[model samples]
Target chain A: MRSHQTVVDSRLRRRRTAETVFRFFLLASVILVSLILSIIVVSILWKSLPALKLSMIFKTPGTGYYLGKRGGILNAIVGSIEISFGATLIALMIALPIVIYLNTYLKKKSFLSEIIRLFLDVLWGIPSIVYGVFGFLLMLMCHLRASLLAGMLTIALVELPILSRAMDETIRLVPNELKEASYSLGATRWQTARHVVLRQALPGLITSTLIALGRGLGDGASVLFTAGYTDRITTSLLQPVATLPLAIFFQLNSPFPEVQQRAFASAAILTLLILFISLLTRFLGRKLSRHRIK
Target chain B: MDKGRVLKKEKGRLVAAGLISFFPIFLTIAIFLLLLIKAFPLLSLKSLPDLIFSSAWQPQKGQFGLWPFILGTIWVTATAFILAAPLSILTALYISDYASVRLKKWLAPVLDLLAGLPSVIYGMWGTLLIVPLVGKFLAPLFGTYSSGYSILTAGIVLAVMILPTIVNVSVEVLSAVPAELKEAALSLGATRFEVVRYVVLKKSLSGVAAACVLGLSRAFGETIAVLMVVGNVPVAPVSLFSPAYPLPALLANNYGEMLSIPGYESALNLAAIILLLIVIIFSLVARLYLARLSRRRDR
Candidate 1:
């Protein structure tokens, strides 16, 4: 009896040890991920602090900027805002309508909606470089040069699936009962979508737009070929535009230390902008959710 | 007359929505066809197998063998998956099962921030920190030398870039597992860990697999970050320490200056097509699998 009890005790001890080890690993992984995030933020900030200046945001890169001359990244900053904003606006116009149609006009889990969702999923997974290539081809076909218009079109394709899917999920969250109430009031489908669904999904729509904007703002590959970079600020949709991601890429690739330092500064600025947008998303999501009905 | 006007407006809105909804489908088809048409010239020059399997990549000399790049992409993506899959899965498990409410709230925004950061920033960070650490410390410890811009360095950076996707999806999947199932295991004298292991993980196995596949797809097509740190060598990588070039990098680097060369544009377009095909296939498979899994569960 004593031997059997000892055997049971040993088995229990083994199980207990296994559980402890497993939990330890789980905790370690969480800490490791958090540590990596902090490391990325801290290291970028550390390298960029010495080179970052207030004037960098206001002035355009002058001649000999790549040779370590004095200048700013205003051209890139302005161009990035223009291209991403243009893309987001274009994506929203299409995405909002499609999302509303899917959620309200069609039955839940209809075959057509399923197929559309599948296509969006695949589109979301396509690499930005592919879009760049496609955009280049489209430009050739249209006899258009590498310009801000081309960049906006390419980035719009990138943002479309993201915006549609995000809005689709959010619009799905609106209760059927709400739509039914609108219908009982003799409202048409469009009126119900505009008044009932759109009102309830306003916060989600804003959040989705912000997310797509962030994506477009940060993406470098899709614009690499389509948005030919220029030192001067873009004055027209037909002219080439500079962007922050390309600024970072070109600066880092330079053989000069000062140029590389500017690269770090550019990265810092982009990271901070994206970080602000992310936090704003969370804050806005919460503030807007107060108006949502459950 | 007012009611008639309202009806007419509704009809117009429906027609507009229907047409706009087809735009994405039309765009997808156009992209694929354009790539195929552009890539056709290269296929006429060389067989598909030769184009894909040949190791020589001198664009100036008219050779466009993509074997080295194909292998390089496979190596870096596999390394990233190996490094990230476990960490993300465990992180998801911890967040869902072990993290306190306060910790969960704090972690959400942190993960979102991580996810939102651009690839260029990740690449810059890798170049500044990871590249030197590998070139100086890890390589020497392993009795080798590297310039810190190697496949391993790229893999490490890419792994971190993809962490948020895997973890977020897995957490969603794990949280969806019935709480009652976990409680039942606990009531039957199983420890919390065992209950999670036997019940939660078992039930959510397909979902976790889908999350990993999604992460893999993201890692596969990531361009700028991988290009920045991946040494951009055209040779196939033999070891983790070797510099390599990936397909996206190849497409991005060669598009502008070399269009004057014969067949160069077509070759680059073919590379883009290959990337598109791979990413599309993987994501579709994962989505379909998840759909099937959920359908089964619902029944």
Candidate 2:
């Protein structure tokens, strides 16, 4: 009996020790993520300080800046904004309809919706580079050269799955009873979706669109070949345009120290843009959650 | 007339919805077809085994072997999964089982932000911070020459980039474990940790596995960031510190120039096809596993 009791005690002690170690491990992991985030922010800022000027936001990238003269990445900034906006608009137009159709046209557990979702998942899992390759192929097929329109089309493809998935989740949360109520009031499915579903999911839809926008703006690989880089900003969709990520990639690859500093500055700008979008989405998400029908 | 108008409107709406719904399916098939069509030229250029197993990638000499790139991609992605899996699962567990409501709220957005951040920024961060640290500090300890751009640096950056995906999916899985199940475990004299370990983790094992699969898919497909810090070497890496090239990186780095050389376009297209196939398989497996996990939970 004494030995049995000792064995039990040892087992209990071992289990307790394991629990403690696991708890510490969990805490360390969380802390490590937070630490990396702060480090990324701090290091980018530190490195970018030499070239991040208020004037940089206004001036176009001067040619031969790799020779260590003055310039800004405004051209890339404007180009990024144009491409992202165009892509997000296009994605929203397609995604909103698809998500609405998925939720409304099909039964809640419809196999069609399941299959559609699986397709989107596959598309979502495809790498940005593959999308770029596809875009490049499309460009070739059409006998079209690289341009902003090509980039927008490629990014639209990339953002479609993300936005649609998000909107689908939110639309699923719209109470079935509310749709029933709309239908009982003699509303058509299209009217019900427009009036009840869209109204209810407006906040979430906005947030999802913004998230997709952020993705479209920040993606480099998808646009690398499709949107051939240019030194100057072009308003025309036919013209190739530069973007912050490609600019940073190009500048970072240069042998010049000043060009490298500019890469850091571009990094800072890109980070700030994404951070702004993220914070906005978070704030909107919180607000929507508070208003959500539990 | 009024009833006819209503019927016509309904038909129009349904048709519109059906057309839109078909778009994703159409797009998926189209992408596959496009890849296959463009990559067909390589079929005559080299045999399948020779193309994939040969190690030399001299474009000028028309030698397009993919074995080295495959090896490098596997090494970087496997190392990233190793580094990210434990941390991500633990963080997910903490958030789901241990965190307060307020903390959960705070953490969710940050993870979302991390998930949404661009891959290029990750590459930039890898270049600016990880590479230098590896070159100046870590490489010496590993007995490798310092260039800051190696398989290890790329793996570390990919690890960070993949963490949010794993954590988010794992949290969703753990959260789906019914509250009563956890309560019962606690009532049976299990400590909080014990309940989490035996009850939550066990129940969510498949879901966590699914999350890891998704993360692997992401790591495999990631391009510019991995391209930036991976040193772009075409040879297979012998060690973590050695410079290597991944499939996506190779595709991205060479696709532009591929058009200029004979048979190069077909080679790059084959690489993209390989990447697409691997990522698609991983994603489908993940989706299936997650579906099974949820079904089991529901039962």
Candidate 3:
């Protein structure tokens, strides 16, 4: 009896020690992840503080900006916004309808929906560099030069899968009873979709749009060859556009400290824009969920 | 007249939506076909073995071996997976099994934000921090010389980028492990950790594998962040400290100037095709696996 009790006590102690070690390991991993995230944000902010100025957001780069001359990143800021918004608009036009069709018109677990979802998933996984290559090919075939129009179309393709999938998941969450109620009122499928499904999914739709927009804004590879960065901002769709991502890439590559500083500044602006969009998504998602019927 | 016209209008709308829905499939096919067609010249010019096995990459001399980039991608991706898998699994376990309700709620959006941050931002951070740390500290510690831009730096950056992806999917899979099984294990006098390790991990093993595969696919295709920090040397990486060039980086760096060299454009296209194939295979396999896992669980 004494020997058995000692064995049990030792086993219990070993198990307790093992449990404590495992718990600590998990806690440390979480802390490490949070630390990494904070480091990214803080480092970017710290690096950009010296070079970031309000004028950078309001003025275009002047002559010899790459040589560490005085200038601003207005061209990049405006161009990033324009390209992303245009791409989001295009992606939304196609994505919203497809999502609506999938959720309302198709039967649950239908073959077509399954295949479409798979295709979107694959597309979403395709690298931006592949999209860049595809976009370049399309441009060549069309005899189009690198321009804002080219950038917008390319980014729209990139955003399409992401936007549609996000919207699809959101629309799928709308309770079936709500849709049935609309149908029982003798509403046509289109009316039910337009009024009921769309309204219920508005928050998600907006959130997905912003998400796609943020993605579009941050992508540099797709526009590396297709967008053809320029110093001055041009309103024409045909003109090559400066974008924040490309701006950072090009400036960082320069063998000049001041220019590298500007790159950090561009990075800061891009990060801020993405951060704002993310916060807006959370805020709007909660605020708009109030009217949503679960 | 009213009912007939209304029905006809609804039918028309359905047809339109259906056609629009086909766009994804069509786009997928188009991308594949276009890449194949563009890559055909290079595929025909060089024998498959020579192209894939040879490391010679002189564009001016019509040499376009892809072994270096392929090997680089493998090295970087493998390192990333090594570093990320354990951390992500542990983080997921913590989130699902250990975190309080309030902590879980806060962590969700935080992870999402991390997921949604632009790859360029990660690249920038990697360039500023990871590169310096590797070159200044890590290289000396290992008694090696590095230029700060190396495969290891890229891997560390990529590991951070893919952490959220693996963790999110894993949390979902971990959470799906039935509470009853955990409770049963607890009643047997098992510790929470033991229950999680024995019951939850056993049940969700396949799902977690699928999640890691998904993260691998993301790491494979990530270009900008990897491109920024990965020393884009055309040589195959022999060590963690060696400069490496990945396929996506190869295409991103060269496609702009490929018009000047004969067969260069085709070689770059072939690289893109290779990248697309790898990413598609990994993603489809993982998605199908997860889909089947969920179906089986439901049953």
TM-score of chain B of each: 0.97, 0.97, 0.98
> Candidate 1 on A54-133: residue-level lDDT in tens?
87888898878889898999999999999999999999999988998899888998999988888888888898888888
Instruction: Report the CA-based lDDT of candidate 2 relative to the real structure.
Output: 0.89
Residue-wise C-alpha lDDT for candidate 2, range B79-167, written one tens digit per residue? 89999999999999999999999999889878887887788889999987899988888999878696989999999999999999999
| Model 2 TM-score relative to the real fold | 0.97
The TM-score between candidate 1 and the true structure equals 0.98
lDDT by residue (tens digit), candidate 3, A1-294: 579989999999999999999999999999999999989999999999999988788889888878988789999999999999999999998998899889999898999999989999989989888998999899989999999999999999999999998899899888899899999999988989999999998999889888898889998889988999888886999999988998998888899999999999999999989999989989998898888877
Give per-residue CA lDDT, model 2, range A110-190, as digits (tens).
899989988888888888899999999999899888999999999999999999988998888899999999999998898
Q: What is the C-alpha RMSD of each candidate to the true structure, in Å?
A: 1.2, 1.7, 1.2
Clashing pairs in 1: none
Q: Give the lDDT of residue B123 in candidate 3.
A: 93
Interface RMSD values, listed in order for every candidate: 0.7, 1.1, 0.9
Q: Which stretches of candidate 1 lie over 4 Å from their true place?
A: B297-299
For all candidates in order, the CA lDDT equals 0.92, 0.89, 0.92
lDDT of 3 by residue, B90-156 (tens): 9999999999999998898889889988888899999999999999999999999999999999999
Worst 10 residues of 1 chain B by lDDT: B252-261
Using Cα atoms with residue i matched to residue i, what is each candidate's TM-score against the true structure? 0.98, 0.97, 0.98
